[model samples]
Target: MVRVIMGVKGTGKTKQMIDLINSAVHSEHGNVVCIERGGKLTYDIHSKIRLVESSNYDMGTFEFMKGFISGLYAGNYDITHVFIDSLTKIVNADVTDHTLEEFLDWLNSFSEKNNIKFTVTISADRELASEGVQKYF
Candidate 1:
């Protein structure tokens, strides 16, 4: 399952994502593998769920996807759910506005074959990027 929680800035998208994740882990007793884009996951929550933090380390789109896909393929069998916070931040560093389509295609394929539940967040202003992403998925 893939879900995108989108809205304008200051709309509490990150908080909403965190709440949803927390609910799944704490209330429902679900195993959650959370991928946090910013430091929000570390500083904002208190839980025993597995958390992976990836911030702006100058990684490009391909490099980011490579690490993400490889990690997921290798470790997915151990977890039941995956939450990817703010998908836009993964590509924000480059902001290439190029290779968006290709990246989206790869993401769609990877998500499907892995059969992992994913939560993706994005900015409301990134229409092209978001549209390309939704189309591919």
Candidate 2:
């Protein structure tokens, strides 16, 4: 399953994701992974959930992010839920709209094949976002 929390800045998207991640830690049988663009979430997230800082890897583009995520799954097959704190922040500022759409489409398919659930927080208004980006939300 793929869930998206879409809204503008300061709308509590991160808080919502934190709550979901913290709550899932108690009941999920498999591992829970949280990916953030920076170290901001180090304290709010539960200690049990595996937190990854995207800056540690070459994920400036969504294409690279796909490989990074695939490698994570390859290394740890037990990961069930992957929470991306801010999808927009991980990508390079100059990327094309097509890149975002392609990555999201691939993510949805990848989750289906691996039985992993992905919850992403996108900091953009649903209406103002591109048709490609809006579809994911």
Candidate 3:
């Protein structure tokens, strides 16, 4: 189950995600993993939450993506939900040789094969206008 919640900055996107995480970790007994990229919001979650700081904006795209993917598969056993604070940051940071579309496609495939539900928050300003928009999460 991959979901994307997009909106303009300060439109409660991150806040919405945090709220969702709070509920899932507090009530659903789900393991919530959040990849924080912007160094903006931080909170104390229950025992079910694991917060990983992927970057503070200084890290490039490939580095952040590699770390995020590595962190997602870091441990063993049931992690119910994974949320990336801003998918745009990851996409923009990816300065790899591959095209942006290719990278996103690879990520989509990776998520599908892993059976890990993910929520990617992207800013409205960064949302690309194209047919491939449907491919995101």
Candidate 4:
């Protein structure tokens, strides 16, 4: 499943995502991974959970991010949950752009195909986000 945590910037979205990741790591039997722009939250997450810094890789577009996620699934079959903080930052686009919808659609399909859950944090309020994308919030 694909879940979105939508809110404006500086609204503690990262904190919420981090808390969710922590909870998932402690409760779930499978592995949990949190992907962010930098390794800023590496210290905050539990040691058992994987912390991936997206900036270290070449993820300049939405498609690249999707491929990177696909690579993660390819490399780790035990991953049950993926927490992506700052979705807009990683995609380097506004939340209202058409690419957001495309990415969400791809993510939905990817999640279902791999039987993995994705929790994403978008830097936009529910009302500010596109109508089609708000349903995941």
Global CA lDDT of candidate 2, please? Answer: 0.84
State the lDDT at 34 in candidate 1: 74
Per TM-score, the best of the predicted structures is: 4
The local distance difference test score of model 1 is 0.63
lDDT of 2 by residue, 1-137 (tens): 77778888899998899899999899788999999988988999889999999888857877788888899999999999999977878886422367677777899999999999999988777666666666666
For each candidate, the alpha-carbon lDDT, in order, equals: 0.63, 0.84, 0.63, 0.86
List the candidates' TM-scores in order.
Answer: 0.70, 0.91, 0.70, 0.94
Local error of candidate 3 at residue 82 (angstroms): 1.1
How displaced is residue 20 in candidate 2, in Å?
0.7
List model 3 lDDT by residue over 29-52, tens digit each: 446787777555464444457776
Better of 1 and 2 by lDDT: 2
How much does candidate 3 score in TM-score?
0.70
Steric clash pairs (candidate 3)? 61-93, 61-94
Ranking of models by lDDT: 4, 2, 3, 1
lDDT of 1 by residue, 21-124 (tens): 77777654346777776566786555677777765445446657657656765865655567766665765632235565455456556667766556666655
Query: Which pairs, if any, clash in model 4?
Result: none
Which residue pairs collide in model 2, if any?
none
- Pick by lDDT: 1 or 3, better one: 3
Better of 2 and 4 by TM-score: 4
lDDT tens per residue, model 4, 12-130: 98888878988998787788988898778988888988888888885779989888888888998999999988888887888889899889888999989888999999887778787
